[model samples]
Target: MTELAPDAGFRGNEKLKGALLQHAALSPAGLSERLFGLLFSGLVYAQIWEDPEVDMQAMDLSEGHRIVTIGSGGCNMLAYLSRRPASIDVVDLNPNHIALNRLKLAAFRHLPDHASVRRLLGEQAVRTNARMYDRHIAPNLDAATRRHWEARGVTGRRRISVFNRNIYRTGLLGRFITIGHLIARSHGVRLEELAETRSLREQRMFFDSRVAPLFDKPLIRWLTRRKSSLFGLGIPPQQYDELASLASDGTIAPVLRHRLEKLCCHFLLRDNYFAWQAFLRRYPKAEEGVLPTYLQEQHYHAIRETTDRVTVHHANFTELLARKPAGSVDRYVLLDAQDWMNERQLNDLWTEITRTASEGARVIFRTAAEDSILNGKLAPDLLDQWHYQAERSHALNTQDRSAIYGGFHIYEKRPA
Candidate 1:
């Protein structure tokens, strides 16, 4: 695990509150924001929703390039290692995310082989995973990270035991998916049946017959109208508003329905692990379903060899970038964080990003709506320094297998 400052968890919580508490505490929006902050302070994403393959292609990563990214579940950062980047500085305001990133790095560096790593992370509920952690991964973790895993949860079992019972099914996002499953079941639909899809045609057919009508239900529509309903998705109050704006009826259900359709229909089920996680609640067997790039056997050796290059920090992205030297970073992956930022925060972040960016540095981010968030929000002087790859962004957005986000953007620094 990478070194951490004293009181890192407390500091991370404070930073998260600062970013999320944008409205007055007494107001409905404020209460929603605070509630989200509380839930987000703990584990959220067991697996990041962004498609790292599309991210890698957008960033055009090359050997020795220095990269900076917001670590969610840490999957993408590990995937990035396959390109042999010189260094990766991962920043996140969520302490759990920081711990998760470090734990993953330790797993890659300390675990005996790819199979053990896969069994621990890729599969669901294996009793041997706790033993594997205790025997191999635990001894290698830093004190802070070790304590995070060893600490008991409400179940009186150590947090690390989640690996023994489906880690992906435990987080806020995981629980949200569980709720979605229950709701679908109540309506007489089995979402997991989509996994049996053999082709895109069958996938679309399954979605249309089994999933599409659920959105039209009076209950789902009403639930989506409330901002609090999406808190399980790690979507804050501000982001909820943006997502709601995307719907023609000014309701969130339609927007969600469209994204879900893409997830179910845009790619082959065998090829999209995101779909596997969504419908099956766990990745399928190696031969039956696709896995993230980092977990694949072909890249395991390379990722493990490069694990030492990653440094995990529990801090705000803008603040971390401010501490770095100018023109030092070659790639930036924002991962939908800008949706939570106010105008001032947006400007502050872009200032540091522009200052730290190397020549031709490429920056990628996602938005809740189908357009770049920077157009009117960021200062012209700052925004003008980068060239938006509108055509490429649209193309890559379509290729993103996660299919949850409305837009995927790529911006390249212009010549001085």
Candidate 2:
């Protein structure tokens, strides 16, 4: 039978077990990091690194396409809805992600207008969010998702009350930013200075002067050595190795430096929301880039109108695809998850994909390496059914505003 899908189950402990370690390459520290990463994935991802603009450009979605994607933060999936696809199915192994996706879907369905959506998701600190959830959003969610948010913490406060504060600053990414700020403070560097840079020249200068030096410090280097320290970045150990392999300087630090440069310099601070949340730990003012596409005022109504076409599943992609009829799905957004799978797992995935995918179906994914993961690993017999769009993939990888991932790949199904 197919290898038991990685982290596939509804039982809480089983889910956690699956989530904890998808890789075999961990040292003791790596194991700790994997555990931390698993726990981190169980909360809201105030931001996901994939660029939906680049994603939509790659998919070029039409009314005829049926889309499936991993609902990491539920951000890109909602962003996908703006295109008015026939249907989109978003799946994730993390129940928290499924919950987040459902909550977003529910918010789109129940919120009165664009301003309400923005205030709740963007500003994210309104005291009335809990009340709004009570009145408009909570009832619409399934029991599991509802219970997940309503569950109490040690303070006896319902976890849903997180929205009453800056919810963007609550999850693993939030804590990571806070810790980064703390580290920067100890080094006499204000992490916020990146936000004040006026242009690419200024940003590069500021980075060279202020940010780049932080990497060379003893404490920063010490912490960076422990893979657990990066769990906050949503980086798993497998992907960590892939990224580490890319460093021309033989350290992960340079790879990070290049990525930071891309995040800060390649895109203007006024427009890149990912950089805003990263450097400033919150989104910019509404007049600026402000928010993700799904949360933007211009796209709100379109997403709201089409939100009903979306559904969230707490399952592995291969498992989800296995149940679908042949030639049913037209688009797949794999995110960077295959980095977590083994060669057999990858082949198992393509086995189902080759079966279920419609003619001309497009599958897109990102990787921690600039080169492809599937090129040498995936079984050639299964791979031959699809054509890799290398030039477009490389071009799109450059255009990707996220700038975090090293590769963006696209594959199209061949004529049978």
Candidate 3:
């Protein structure tokens, strides 16, 4: 994992206070702190670092459609950008995630070139990359964001700060996985070894024998009981309730086992670069391409250029949707954002989503529970107006990068 610089000044700050409050509510059972110490032992940036469901066949970008996405780690946004949409707006409540998105954007725009950009973010080597950021990238940051990134750390170079500090809680589900890795490492088995597999069978074997067995241990199982611990993995408290229901007595291992199986056994480990990043390097796919996209180098520039039309917002999905004009967006990628909301929040989010629907606009999101969030929670009047692409959901989930998410739902707004 890239070591983020230490934030010695974090104590007594509002950000720390907010994180504390969030951790308290998210981990009400009091197990999160211990699990957190065992796992992260530092700043956590929980993120779903995988791509959102991308359906190239159904999407005709030249038809001109605006898109809104939850933008966990902005991977989906970059992938979506490859389709050449009219515009894409990405929102996230986590400031760190927002900053991470900006950093990604900066890398795309200002790095010495594509190769260097890849080296900086992919390999995570920061010496020369720090020079690149200090000379070019830092000047482009918005004031508040600049301060956020510039907060001094052990590394005098601000870019190195991301590596020097603990950045586990910034995205969707990454933080929890980071926590898991830390904890599992403390127990002796290196989760990073799962990345050493040369074949799909080896990957499967490593997961079953070396990796999954660690979770079966008594202490790890006990740690899984905490909402905060799960939150670190980007499992919101509300979703944890549903996941608990999946087992007879609401045990977490079964749910975790199911998720891990999907991640390891369901796909080719060599092609699943997201898994390689999570379990091995603790970074995104490098410039040379890692797994799935390694062979698709032709799409790289198209992907890079798509960055221009995308704007990252440091706000919740509901808040972002609320500001959008009616019928202005054609695609929505809400990656398990509903898992974190209450019914009221869910209603508001869908209401704005429905209000913003353009003709044949497609909205995609994931859920912790097998069921879609729209069932009874969304009023029938609005739900009925939109078409659920259940078949498409199944197909995409099968193809999803990490395969850890439960339900991948797609909704299409009827023509006005």
**Best by the TM-score measure:** 1
Per-model lDDT:
0.90, 0.80, 0.63
TM-score of each: 0.97, 0.92, 0.82
Off by over 4 Å in 2: 1-41, 248-250
Residues 189-214, candidate 2, lDDT per residue (tens digit)? 98788877788788778888988888
User: Per-residue lDDT for 199 in model 3?
Assistant: 75
TM-score head-to-head 1 vs 3, winner: 1
What TM-score does candidate 2 get on C-alpha atoms?
A: 0.92
Q: TM-score rank, highest first?
A: 1, 2, 3
| Clashing residue pairs found in predicted model 2 | none
**Candidate 1: lDDT over CA atoms?**
0.90
What local lDDT score does residue 174 receive in model 2, on the 0 to 100 scale?
80
* Candidate 1 local Cα displacement, residue 125, angstroms: 2.4
Instruction: Report RMSD for candidate 3.
Output: 5.5
Off by over 4 Å in 1: 1-12
Model 1 agreement with the true structure over 143-219: per-residue lDDT tens digits: 88898888886779988899998989878999999999999999999998887778899998999988999999988
Q: Where's the lowest-lDDT run of ten residues in candidate 3?
A: 1-10
